[model samples]
Target: MQIYNFSKDNGKKIGIFNSNFIMSRIIETNKGAHIGCMYLEENGIIGYHQATIPQLLLILDGEGYVCDEKKEYFKVRSGDSIFWEKNEWHETKTETGLTAIVIESEELNPSLYMPKKHWDVSSVSF
Candidate 1:
């Protein structure tokens, strides 16, 4: 049982992310549960990616869009939370910028996947 504060931790640009963004990790554990705050600058793209465990991104501020492997795209804003099932491929798009809290399991056995060669962005909207 521990209390983690987002504002207390200093953020750093993670190299693993293809996008130009920074994240501040609130909890770094050896077992389950990891939390962090991520910020993406304008026109930044997280790129289609996958996670090992289930992930939930709680939008804290700004706005953005999320798309799944099926090209299912949707808008997200502050206070909204999006969930990605284990190993689910997804991507984020931001025209202005975005800030959100990312939560996932620390014992992640991630298996990344390649994105589809072709897709229509206007295929889905919400």
Candidate 2:
């Protein structure tokens, strides 16, 4: 097991995240899993884009808005958890700023090792 303290280390700048924000990577496992903390200052935004892997977002502080491709949006506050599947289009903005922890995969198709089903559960299939 590995441990990290984001507050002790200065975070690296990445991608098209709002210039005023910071995304600090805490750990990147050999399995391609990534854990990071993000700080978005008031009015900071993460623009619309489709993800290539499954992701779980954990909001740690403050409040914000998260949106889908349809342009519909929802408010999220601290302690909220949001999940987005591969290729899901989404965006985030903090009108009053917020901090969140992002957990995702580095590889485009990392394995979560789900168990194979013995019985088919599809409603449309026989």
> Each prediction's TM-score against the native?
0.59, 0.59
Off by over 4 Å in 1: 1-31, 106-126
What lDDT score is found at residue 1 in candidate 2? 9
Q: For candidate 1, lDDT tens digit of each residue in 30-124?
A: 78687899999898778888867777676678888888777677766664556677878888888999988778874432221111122234445
TM-score of 1: 0.59
Q: Judged by TM-score, which candidate is best?
A: 1
> What is the lDDT, from 0 to 100, of the residue 111 in candidate 1?
22
- Model 2, range 1-126, lDDT digits (tens) per residue? 011223313445555744655554433355667778999999988888897776766667887877666656666676455666788888888889999988887542212321111222311110
lDDT, candidate 1, at 51? 62
Model 2 segments more than 4 A misplaced: 1-31, 106-126
